[model samples]
Target: MADSSCGPRPLPPDDLALLSGLQPHDVRKVAESKIQAYRAMIEDINGYIIQLSTIQNTTVPLHASLPPEILMHVFRHILPTGPSDLRLTHVCKLWRDLIFRTPEFWVDMLAISAVTAHLDHNTDSPLSFPSFVVRSSPLPFELDLHRGALDFLRTIPSHVSRIHSLSLHLPLGSDYAAYLTALFNLDMPLLETMRCSTYATAWPIGLTDSTTHRVPDGQKFPRLRKLAFCGPGLPTRAFAFPSLRELKFDDGMFSEPLGPLMDFLESCAQLEVLEMNIQSPARQFRTERDAVSLPHLKIFSLLLDAPEGLWAYDFLEQVIVPATAQMNITWLAGSDHPLRYLIPTSPLSLSVEAIQVIHTLTIRFNYDRTVRDDSKWILSVNGFVPSHSQPYLKLTIHCPCWTLEEDVRPSDALSDLSGLFTCAPSLQKVKLRLDHGITVTPDHWFVILNSFPSLSSLTVRIGSCRSLLTVLRRNPTRWPALRRLSISCRNGSGVHECLLSAIERRAREGSRLEYIAFSGSPRRRLSEHRMRRLEGLVDEVTTVNEVEFCGMH
Candidate 1:
């Protein structure tokens, strides 16, 4: 037979002679091996057909056939990050074309990285950081970079007017005060928000000093609404922005007179929010009868360092914050002035003492996260004064948190807080945190509960229900008004027994609780029999497998 008889190239004549000499079984084996190889080739060809069919069958993976307009829109949503975003340009020639065509993507390059090893880095090149920004000219964009990267700004001075939001951070431990000083000399008509923070290493000896000569009215950023200039040794110039609405100055600014600081603030008439970390003035603040009054200001946060209470009070007296404004002032740690006396008496008549009643009084004792000391505790007495006439006052006294007695909670911390509860004599609801090391014993709990005589509802997480059981077994513990109880049922079945015994004792005293709620202990949620037993003791009983309660308020 010919070599092509089987529709495959026949073996060579020498190979054919060898195969003819082989046994019939050997020939069958060779044919079977060729058949298997042909089958694998057929399967591979079918796989391509199936994938092609799937591509024709599905409408998903929209990018596979995306229109140019839709692709552009998709590219527009990607925030311009550094190297990570630049890597996307190399995916294909189409992406590179899109990235260059949409110049907006390159507008927000923060090129002032301290560690980026762009040894080829410079603003002078055509495809460098400066070029990317230049491509976005005539369009409003954001500029956020370290002060060292001001060359990027110099490279695109023509596009400076189009910048909308500019944030310049001073390089760490570096002096670029001269660059920051010259920045104010430019015109930015479209700028809305400017955040400039740096430690000014040296003061500028300019043609006109800030202390003596104010920046001429409307000199820069005519449309600016927000300005935050922070850190010590800041520029001594007064900024005059007609449209300024928000201003924040941190306390690092030093050796400047209060008059200059106030003078700078007086220039902005439309400010609605002012946050300042009050520092000791260079000179004493002379009482001025004609102080600036912020009529539209809504929020004033003052952070005062030590030995600044007198300054704080003087500042409060000088400025007239409107009745509607909210004030938060953190003074020296050991401030002797009470919170009630510290707040300026306002036309709104909103005072700490006005909190007559609270819906929930939550007292939690936990490790203070803010303080580094592990031995100390943070006791938060949280409550919200329920009202709608104006902003409701939230009264929270961090008592045991401030006490120096680290090992044991000070008795005075809780006892002294009688004044707080007394202020809200009609307080009805209460939640007590007792999971941590609560120094208050069963008798101590009674005094605290008795303090809030009108408390009709109570939720407690105790070391064990044992202390609470002790309280309920007694005469005074039979709270005449405490109708609802929420207890954390942890520890063991002894907790349930403690609860049942307390309920039975209360019932015997003819002062049974109207409702009882149990929470925590997932697997051991009360069985139906136990719940029914509890139902007989109280008007109603409810159990939850797992429960979590938030802060006191």
Candidate 2:
């Protein structure tokens, strides 16, 4: 009989006959198997739901808390370009509204061909800049307009009037008169600096006419301090600026006579610094013995490519003696030969005290060919060295040569150097360069180094390392006061190690060696371990607490 406590009894397919045929164990096994399969199916469904919920939590967008105004300021500092920066406005309504209204972001404009290539090809007017620049902030600003944008700038009266610093580079043969006329008329009362480089064909002839209308009389740039003109065929007529302190004329083709240029300088009485490089081969200047002097001129640099035999020194002497007697003068002449003869020796004696007052003197002797031995040349240089009455002198000598064969070795050329050192007993620092392929014997090196007893720092550049080490071993005492030593040679690996060992040996014996630099070409495929070992020995020296090993090609 079936148990009634089991709730309800199952119906048999063939009633009692089928039930009698089946065993109780088989029925129990089938029922248990079915239960296990349904349990596993439910677990899989639950796991899938959990995975979907986790993905939703991680992939959702999060809103930023920064204010729109601060974000716009950040954007203003970046040069405007790139899809990422442009699409930033589309991220939200707040960003779009803030960026569109901030005109300060557009005040300082720079339009270049590389950046505006797409705009240049699509429009009839390549320079139709986005209107934001035309209606920007009220603050004085800078405008850098390059390539073919000068024509577009002429139409923007508002932009021109507010520019405090303007840089324009226009093509050759463009009508720059309209642009200049606009600049001359613009009421940029606060404009302080202007740099313009224009290349134009047909030469701006109208700009050269001295009789053309001038900058309004009595109008002065009270705050303007600097002006630079880098253009071809610039008019030489005088322009007035009473408050200008620095003036630079670079690569300008002079059209008018020197009289007008001199007049322009005289007008700027407050001018302190003047740099002019005249490129016109045909331009000539008439010397005015009674021309106005530059009373306030502190620094003057004139670069000219005149006839070799031209009496440029006469003009320079005239300018120097009266106008700027108290000024520290720096004269650079680009000539085929040395101009040591042209430099007046008589003036040296007259102004020896005044010239000695100059804190720094730089003489750049540019020679195309080998400098032939000139006795007068040596005497001229020696004359400039102040007498012992002046304070100690700091000297720097730089000679970049292709080969040492052309250089006059100190041993062979010690007479001039001896005279120079004797004239100035206060010499403190000396630098000597012997270019590649030039060899100096150990004996000659010793003689040269010993000449400057007061030098605290010495740099010797040689072509061969073996030769340099031989020299150092011979006379280490000559460099007792040297706190810094710099050596450049060809074979550096073994030489560097030897130098380090020698310096250490000296330091252990009580020598002051503070700094050492070994510059040379390294051995092929040297490992870092080897390099470090070489560096460590030099570092261990007493006077040299720090050492540098560089591998230069």
Candidate 3:
């Protein structure tokens, strides 16, 4: 408070006198120490001056002031995963430095297409493949090599040890056996996933060697866990995969017998998810080999697109899925078996370990053009646990014809459904949706409704509601437990007469429906008189658009 001015204080007189009495050497030492102190003071002052100038003349960015660790985290959060992340280097010097130092941003940033484009001088990429491989450093990385990237494929063997995932998108007839053999010969200690797909094309032409990928006799993938292989056969023989947890095989042109493939699967007992989609599966299994048991399997999907006899069922009989797994099988319907016999004559025909009781059933008949623009009907049967959106058991039958008069008759389909009802005696709900030009007779509806003794809800959406309403009108006590009923007509035909008669008959028999929902196109909405009549019959009546009704149900 005495003198608030900015300046150095003078040394006390006694201290100055002590310095004046020093000898020559002492004086020199004291001078050097004082010089060092003054120089440090001057340097601090210069720093202050610079800081003040910066505050006054320029703005300091907030990011520049942030610590490097925080900046790295921010950069990772804002950056994309692939080559797009490299654009951050152009933002500023701090960002560039942070991105360069952080290895995670460069891990998944390498794509063969971009790298080869740079190699071929096709584009001026910011970072070359070699640069990324170096900048990513010792951390594990994912690699993607598409068809015709043999130049990069040649470089894979050098870096295969550190790869976490490798995906090779070979086209129909790729000839990368030498490169693939070279890559597989090396041990991938860090590899967790490997996918070799032909992009849904034909299989490869030749094997790596006469037998398998000359993979050093006993070479194995020590840490490999997930594998998705699609081709005529696996690239390697019974090479051990002790850590494999997920496996998927999708080969549309698999022509080999089941013996070799089954022998390969017998080694992977720890698999949790297995999916096999082969257009034509092997019809016979080696009699000496027992069913392959997957104790830890959580999801199993087998799609046999062959339009032959029960190959899907035969494949299921060869795999022993645990009771806890969810299963889906899509089999093409053959011309010999009726629609009812397309599935196993009984659920016992499937592996006992794979069967789960059905509580809810959904059958949908819709037209599809998947088979070369032909008119086909896809009958998808989905069974689910209560309150579950994902089906536990899904069976799909693909038929070449779409109408009742065609390859499949509605009565035969109902008879097949009745057989399914025998399997699920406790079935509580059923939903049937038929597209246009497919109509069932009232007798078929009568048989199907009487089969579900415990069905509490029934929803029907067809071309016409005449058969269903007539079935209900004839007998009100058929489905004694059906409390909810929803009906929609595709043609939007006037259903008021038949619908009112059905509801009146049910009411007269003391079988009152708790909820009734009727839907059709907007052009065929129920008139005011019909709406009042329906509301008076049912406790809760809803008149919705056909689209909204389907969505809500």
Backbone clashes per model, in order?
Answer: 2, 8, 0
Model 3 C-alpha lDDT per residue in residues 276-308, reported as the tens digit of each score: 877765445666767888888989887776665
Cα lDDT tens digits, model 1, 181-217, are 5676678889899887765554344312345545445
Better of 1 and 2 by lDDT: 1
Model 3, backbone clash pairs (residues 3+ apart or across chains), number: 0
Q: What's the C-alpha lDDT at position 548 in model 2?
A: 38
Query: In model 2, which runs have C-alpha deviations exceeding 4 angstroms?
Result: 1-64, 77-93, 108-130, 146-154, 169-179, 201-222, 235-239, 252-260, 278-282, 289-292, 298-315, 318-334, 341-356, 359-553
Model 2, 1-553: lDDT tens digits are: 9899987786555444434655799766665765687689889988887677554533444314455566777767766543234465575555555665655544533333333333332243413453544435565666665665556556566665566776666444334455555556556676788676766545544455545535334253456778787866342433456667888876565444444455566566667777766565345456644544666775665555342212334444434332223322222322222233232323443222223233222222223235553311221121123333222222222221111235453334332233234223445555554435446566655655565566565555556766556666555565677666666666654565567555655565555467666566655322466556445534532211112322210
- TM per model? 0.56, 0.49, 0.65
Give the C-alpha lDDT of model 1. Answer: 0.60
Error (Å) of candidate 1 at residue 231 is 2.0
* Candidate 2, position 396, lDDT: 20
| Lowest lDDT 10-residue stretch of candidate 2 | 375-384
In terms of TM-score, the best-performing candidate is 3
Error of 1 at 248 (Å): 4.6
